[model samples]
Target: MTDEAELLQRLWNREKNSIDEAIQIYTPYLSTVLYYMAGNSLPKEDIEEIVADVFIVLWKNAGRIDSVRFTIFL
Candidate 1:
């Protein structure tokens, strides 16, 4: 696993590769959470969309994120 602080720094720097790293590191967890939260109301594709949207939002707000206190999802 990549160091969280390094990932955060790379993200804040707007490094494209860091988005891929973050997706790889966080996708499974996010998918599972979305699955439970949706509770059968949403289709698989919708859950997937939500997960993707999360990364998009994160990337958009990367510069505003605080590495030292980073806790957006875990």
Candidate 2:
């Protein structure tokens, strides 16, 4: 498997470091996307809270999410 695919699996399994890995890899990207999704109308603090909420949900649901090939997280 690709390194990222393995990392994703680790996330699904709740490996201790997996969320940190995700933060390292995905936070910047997701934050940028969410900024655009919010039309840049929200304040930075609100955006940050939204981002945290999203990750929390991902953490909660990771194990139950169906993946075609470990290619989907949201």
Candidate 3:
């Protein structure tokens, strides 16, 4: 598997550093997703906040989420 996929699997397994890895890896993608979801109607700051909220949700639900393929699942 790809290195990212391996790291995601580790995160899913509850490795402490995995959360940091996920945030670093997915922030840009999440921002893009939020931007499109908002229809670009929100200000940059608001969009960034929304993206942060999405990561919070992911962290809160880490155990229940299948992090191995979370980017696709999200």
Candidate 1 RMSD to the correct structure: 2.7
Q: How does residue 55 of candidate 3 score in lDDT?
A: 70
Residue 1 CA error for candidate 1 (Å)? 12
Model 1 over residues 1-74: C-alpha lDDT tens digits? 33887899999999999999999999999999999888999999999999999999999999998876665545
Candidate 2: tens digits of C-alpha lDDT, residues 25-52: 8888888988899886998888888878
Residues 19-53 of candidate 3 have per-residue lDDT tens digits of: 88888888899888878888858999998887788
Give candidate 2 misplaced runs (Cα > 4 Å).
72-74
Distance from true location, Cα of 22 in model 1, Å: 0.5
> In candidate 2, which residue pairs clash?
none
Q: Name the candidate, 2 or 3, with the larger TM-score value.
A: 2
Each prediction's TM-score versus the true structure: 0.88, 0.79, 0.69
Relative to the true structure, how large is the alpha-carbon lDDT of every model? 0.91, 0.78, 0.76
| Winning model by TM-score | 1
Q: What is the lDDT, from 0 to 100, of the residue 50 in candidate 2?
A: 83
lDDT of 2: 0.78
The all-Cα superposition gives candidate 2 an RMSD in Å to the true structure of 2.6
